[model samples]
Target: MKHQATPYFTFNGNAGEALDYYKQIFHGEVINLQTFGEADFETPEEMDQRVMHAQFKKDALFFMVSDSFTDQNVKTGSNIALVLECESTDEIQTYYDRLKNDGNVLMELQDTFWGATYAKVKDPYGITWDLNYTKEQ
Candidate 1:
C-alpha cells in the first residue's frame, strides 16, 4: 500500500490567510477548502467564517491547514502535525493501532464528511499524527 506524509498546521485563526500566503509562495492549486459554517458541526457565529480545512497541492507535494476551534488549546510551536495519507483502509488502521499504543487517541478512527477513514492521535513522544485513507476515485 502507498502512504505519504504531509505537514498539517493548526492556526488559532486566519488559516485562510496563511493558506493564501503559502499558495502564492508555492504557486500551488487549492485542492479543497471548507469553512466551519459549511460543516455539519455547530460553530460560534464569530468562527463560522474561519477555515475548518484546506488543502494545497503543487506537483506531487501537498499541505494542509485548519483553524482551531475556540474551545481547543492551540499553541504555536505545538500546532504542527504529521498527516499520513494511506492508500487503503487496512493501511490506516494498522498505523493507527500501532501508534495508539500508550498514546492518546484524540479522535477515533471513523468515516469523515470529506470521504475518508480518519483519526488523530498523539504519540508517546508528544507528536500528533493524523491518519487518513481515502477510497480510490
Candidate 2:
C-alpha cells in the first residue's frame, strides 16, 4: 500500500515529441516505454505512436510521460504522481475505483500477460499516476 515518488507528465496530445525532447534536453535514456495499442489500452491511430508510458532517467531523477487517454479536457500544468505498486488485485481495483472518482482514469485495471494488475489515472489536479500489482512467482 506504500507509494513511491514518481514524476508523471500528461501531454495534451504530443507525448512522443515531448518525451523525446526531454530525453534530449536532459541527456537521459528512456528506460521503459509502453504505447496505447501495444498494451490493453485502446488508442486512436493518430495517437498509436504516442507514448502511453515512458520513463527517462538522468542519474537519480525519473521522468514519465503519456498522451491524453481520459477524453477529459487536458491543459498545461507542472505536476507529478506518486505511483502505487499494490500487492493484490482487490487492492488494485479498490484503489482504481477510489481514485477514478475524483481523477481521470486513463487505463482500466486489466490482467496482463506480463502478469500484473495495472492501471493509470490523472488526479483532478493534472497529476498523472500508475498502479501495479505484480504476479507472484
Model 1, position 72: C-alpha lDDT score: 77
The positional error of residue 109 in candidate 1, measured at the CA in angstroms, is 1.0
Give lDDT per model, in order: 0.88, 0.76
In model 1, what is the error at residue 9, expressed in angstroms?
0.6
> Top model by TM-score, which number?
1
* The 10-residue segment with the lowest total lDDT in model 1: 1-10
For model 2, the superposed segments whose C-alpha errors exceed 4 Å read 1-3, 40-42, 70-73, 78-80, 90-109, 112-114, 119-129
* Worst lDDT 10-window in candidate 2: 73-82
Cα lDDT over the full model 2: 0.76
Candidate closest to the true structure, highest lDDT: 1
lDDT (Cα, tens digit) per residue for candidate 2, span 1-137: 74565667777667778877887898988877888768675557766776677888899877677777766656656434567889788888998998899998877878776678889888897666788898897
